[model samples]
Target: MLLHTFLAPLALASVAGPAQQDHYGWIHLFDGKTLEGWTEKGGPYDGDADWSVENGVILGREAEGARGGLLYTEQLFGDFEFECDVKINAPFDSGIFVRMLPQKRGAQFTLDDRPGGELFGIYSNGYLFHQSGGDAAWRSGEWCHTRVRCVGHPMHLMGWIDGKLVVDYQVPEGMDEAFTPEGRIGIQVHGGMNDPEDAAVRFKNLRARRLPPMAGENFTVDESGMMTLTAVGEASGWQPLFNGVNLDGWVPNGGSGPMTAEAFEAAGYRARNGVIEALHSGTAGEIRTARTNYRNFQLRMDFQLTKLANSGVYLRSVDDGTNPSFNGTEVQILDDFNWEAASGSKLAPYQFTGGLYGAVAPSKSALRPIGEWNTYLITCVGSRMNCALNGTLLWDVDTATLEPKGGPPFAERAKAGFIGMQRHGSAAESESEVGASFRNLFIRELPEMGPSAR
Candidate 1:
């Protein structure tokens, strides 16, 4: 099906798509009439009732101080897509929240696209999140299209001048490290609560939609000639998480396998076609790193899976019985389309792609399709986990579920371990073996959980 087929049922579709609308996982928020599920914060609900409509335009007047904020919505969202129209009154400021609690200093989201759209300040535990390009463009009174895509825990916020994609930002790494994946979303009318003056702003054609798992064909981009794609200060530099070849510093696990570094070359697992392809797709072994075990690092790789194939990249995995889900943790690499049919629909989020096996599940869905390559970036520390497909949030498990719940949650039992890949058995093999392949393996070590591990 087309993108429309995946996003048509979204609640507030603009009647612009197929039979319904091309809205994905979106839940209807504003009914375009009342604020039934809305609330107030920073200032009053209608800090300035002057926000009423003038014919068809939302007009904003002056309010006291700078506390003209609106913290509405009875819901909060994780990795998803949101879009709306905004018209500012000259030097206006606004905010779109995700993973927030809605208060003056409670995880505020900045949508300021104009010059100085957002100011950077340590709110929770992150630094340099609201780094605006260069405070320059801002119209006194004109409708501006706004779109925000939250993927991989970082929100890719962008502003449009009329119809042009101007401002763009990737939320500084670790910005949402403290914010929960679920919370109430709010809209701000920035001002002082005790004094509301000139804090007037109007919002019309305001709408939002949540998207679903798109094909890999929908995400590849060339950033070539895109000068704005450069990173700003304080942002984490791009780390090479994979080398695009056979597992060099990795070793295969289970049954005392003899597949060592030299063995990889003997089997023609090493290559140079821009990516490493495992020649032995019929084998039941894996290549594991002999160097280090990561706890709070990120892993990204592009892969292609077979029709009835099953596999996963195990994180902090150990050799207890060879089942990563029960041994350590597995980021499910199965096709979301057939995974349910092969195993069951009840697989926990942590057991799927970007999940912590049976411990945690991603807060959103961000997987691509077969033959085409998809990206998987998983971050783990202690029992906490976060994974993203491409740039979308697919899994964000917590510590609560990653505990030693005995048979219920096994991965939690191992604190620190090795990272490995798994090849599982299907009906064709009662031995439950894996025949999947992987290339471009890389890793980065983070500071240990405490001084004890250091």
Candidate 2:
């Protein structure tokens, strides 16, 4: 069906699609002349004054001795981006409510009061993300544009006033079931007090779009010719090591200076359909992130290999002119089915997919065959490490206890270094080109240990 077919019944669509849209296209939540998809939080008889549509804007007001209420959308959203233009009359406590449960627990972006555009949470028994600050973007009698985005996995909120980013915050973990994963968006009118004269709020041009699993996690290129890993989960904390477009964040292993577009292609890193492939490079060596020096992080990626292919993932590795296979801790990725026959012996325990190179072995093989994709989630917090492949736990050990392998003492490996991926030369007998393909390379650095972490 066309885009209009899905959105027309709700409201007159303000914007439609260009047909090839990959993300959520725009949809109008308000239909200017009526409140079709909205209902009052309390019944009409419970509120002091009624909310009504007037001159293309939704207006709410209360009398001097009246109690205020909320107008909410019947539809619920989990991760989404919402935008509207609001004009708040003075002496009114008004705000935009998002991800609110039926019991009225969620977060709010304050509109007017002490200051403007402050974020407050109703979860965790009333928490304030940040205090209201600066001048109020809303004029006494004029309209101001406001935008809000909330995402899942690690719940977060980002907001803007008059096109300027004002609030960016991440809800801390451990308050499970308190903040509802799916809830209705609400426009709140304060309950206690009201202005004797101009006690009202008007909202118009209201619209919303869906957000990703995490915020700012997509691999996108801006007009500046630079790459950006939009913040995901937390505020601007997660970044993509390989953005899957150009090699903007990587450098050829053992090579120095800023990596250029030409040098990246010459090094045999090609991106197609969101996957980075190491093809025909003939062990051209591994590629490492130019920023390097990562300490504690959770890294995730998906890999697919051909029969008899071989490669490795290196973490916290050094660049001493030696290969990352020897300088860093490698998570072995080899063709396990044919390795024993090709090498004339059974595959060693440490030579399988999730092994820690030569220092430690994976508990069992978690390979998903040669053609199917397998996911790897590797998390390193200080000296302890945990790895899982294809939904199966592979190895969880303290690197501080392993015997020394080669370069640094295994216990005293450099606290921070480069991240690399090895390209094995070729297979033993077939000599066919050996390479691997990887996608969705997401990484997030963990915060330092603190009381909250405990």
Candidate 3:
């Protein structure tokens, strides 16, 4: 379902203070006195009716089942910063339109009733951008403080509850074109409404600030004005984790039978759609990291699973020049919720989502709702492995033992080598599907382990 389709009025947009202290901050889209540089564009409003303005808010009283009206600023822009304070009753949703080409490019930053409501997807053009944040604290009849920035190619959106950046996303490039040639800023009354239960959106304190285009150089910066100059050059070479189109750098190992890279990649092990995906049915080989090893590092990826699929990540591996799971230890990834993934596997609490694949179970179940992207970050050092799933630490283990009797073993935990991906057999489960989807795969190798922090 489209994000705007759901309505959960957030508490309130921030009153925190100007996002940019200087005069180059936000240019108010709503001038309390009148509709000024704004107008509606949707159902029944017929570009005729006047949207009410009281106490500074531009109220959008929704029409039953209507897509709602679009409020566009009289001005057009390119690279800029947009921020606003919005509030509405329950079931009401709205979005800040930016760089819209109207009939072509759609809203880049969409805010709705759901918590952490900042969505990055084109109108019907679909999504190629994402980074979302917000809490489910949105109830009816409240206001929300939201802010968005599109400078260079990275779109940073912050959804503030009352007065803080509750959700922040630094959108990567490649998903551009949502904003058009200095287009108008308009408000929409999203199509599909019926009765008072549909939704109503009211916005206030709107502003947009134009900024300069960003180059690769703009990527380096913290909260400090302490600017450091440097030259723009190709970054030093590093082993590619994924080809972004195919799994040309990995080999899966483990469980029952033989699984080859050719076999795995042939079954659609791909690096497409901005993510690396592998669909396995009855494979038994581990996918080993192509080059290099790591003593400690933060490895992160997003995935969606099918019931009964079993897999894991092997770290500090010793490549036999072919399969690696036979050498390194493994970190488990399975849809414990699926009876199939859990078949033969004990149905326990921590064992479900982020467990250490049979050795040490998680302290908590951190899996996301099905179909939602769940993130896992693993840090290994010595005999210690700390894992966090979706911002929550689920497993913290020390002095672990690995056994191939069931899966892979780690005799060299304190040592370092390659990383591996696990492939479980299909017949092992009821439905017997041995696969899932993985995307946004990235890793930042940590410094060599020093004295045990444990």
Candidate 4:
């Protein structure tokens, strides 16, 4: 089957050919003749579901004297599109599960075909959303094409059965804390229901493609070697902090107070042609969001630095003219390759890129080459902070456990404040015009649970 058909509705034509398989990012979960990439015993309740491959399909039946369980992918997926074809005998129950693990209650897309059963409904601890008329789309005893697109931080899920949309739901803000960001995908054979011993559920064409967190938008590089955004739908709550035109929502920290965007520009920062460029000037100061009190949030941005450039991302920074690196927290961003040679000083463990500035060091350096764009995903939830550089996790630490260099413990710092970006003057002695550039700055605030909740 042409898997591209599943993504046609999204207008992702750029990912349509075999030569662009990396861009397509689709992996066939099942080879149609074996269970090489699947396992049945990883989940908490590994049921005795008789699973085998026959006639280019995965066949599942209840083991003798046993009920049923799940068969899950050996690997895990975060945001992705999952597609399959299911054929279930009537009066049997089965489902497709996402973000599933032994310790986590991942959401499920119901394939229940029993009398009075609900198909395509989402279930976790309870019915997240129950399908009202899903049976109308069910093709019993036949291959029913199924697709589920799961994306975003809180997880927006959409399911289609035989090309008919049946489930469209997003995890509510209040319930977002319950669902994890990633886990294994599973196929379930529900237990405890009485049925014929020969009843079975068959699946084939099982495939999935990883998706970016931005959902309907594609970030692409143009022929001129600049990044651009292609929007296809809503960004699912991810809001652009830099509009690619100007710094309207940002203010320059002028040591005494927050200054206007004009001051930010005068301080050598300008947003032009979808990129925020910081000029290499000694007078350049930090720029922060005009909006403050960001308690729990996920911040994503792409940045590229010149040789010996130094910078940091300040989180929950106070507005009292104090250094944000002490008042809140700073994730160090530096030219990891050339900083030591340029500055004549060895970098401490906590001074490396992606480290919690002066507090916790990253496990390893994950920075891209200088002059190449690197992505940062910084998530701050209560007292815990995680930083992933260029898709590799650098650290996931509880800030309350440690103290910043020459500063108070993180537990005593401001719990909620502004998000800022620092433009530390170049480390090179020649005073070169080497500074950092940023783009695609986006943020999504999560539901705030206080420190006690952690």
lDDT against the true structure, each candidate: 0.47, 0.65, 0.51, 0.75
lDDT of 2 by residue, 1-454 (tens): 0000111111111223211112123446788888887867522212444588899999987645667777877666676778899887776767788876656366777765423433332223444565454244545557888888887634678788788777788877875456777677878776666455666889998876543222355433332212346444346455667765767777778777776665655676666666677654532577778877987887877777765567788898888776565555788887687655544556556777888877777787767555555668787777777788765578888778887444565665567788877766433333334367776687878865411111
Clash totals for all candidate models:
39, 1, 42, 0
Against the hidden reference, what TM-scores do the models get? 0.42, 0.48, 0.46, 0.51
Which one is best on lDDT?
A: 4
Writing each residue's lDDT as its tens digit, candidate 3 over 1-454 gives 0001112212222222222222222455565657766645421222322267777677775554354567776565555556666776655455566555545463445555544443333232444444443444344466666665554433444444555545455545654554333455566555454426535677777776544222124222222111122233113111235555556566543322344546666543545454555555433345556554676665655565655555667777675553343355566676666543233334544346676654666777766433334566676766667877765677666635434333345553327777766555443332323266665455555555622212
Model 4: ten consecutive residues of lowest lDDT: 1-10
Model 2, CA-based lDDT:
0.65
**Global local distance difference test of model 1:** 0.47
Error of 4 at 114 (Å): 1.4
lDDT-best of 1 and 4: 4
Candidate 1 lDDT, 109-158, residue by residue in tens: 45443354552221233333444432334344555555555444445444
Misplaced by over 4 Å in model 1 are 1-242, 254-262, 265-272, 278-283, 320-322, 341-351, 400-412, 426-442, 448-454
lDDT of 4 by residue, 1-454 (tens): 0001111111111212111112134566787667887888766657887889898889988776657899998867777778899999877999999988787668999999988889999998789898997899998888899999888658889999999999999898877677777878899888777668767899998887655444355454332324345553224355678887778778777543545656666687777667787766646568788887998988888777766667888899887867788889998888788657545567888888888987888888778555556678888898988888766788888888876775788998999998888877632322345477887787777776422211
Question: What TM value does model 4 have?
Answer: 0.51
What is the lDDT, from 0 to 100, of the residue 60 in candidate 4?
89
lDDT for 29 (candidate 2)? 78
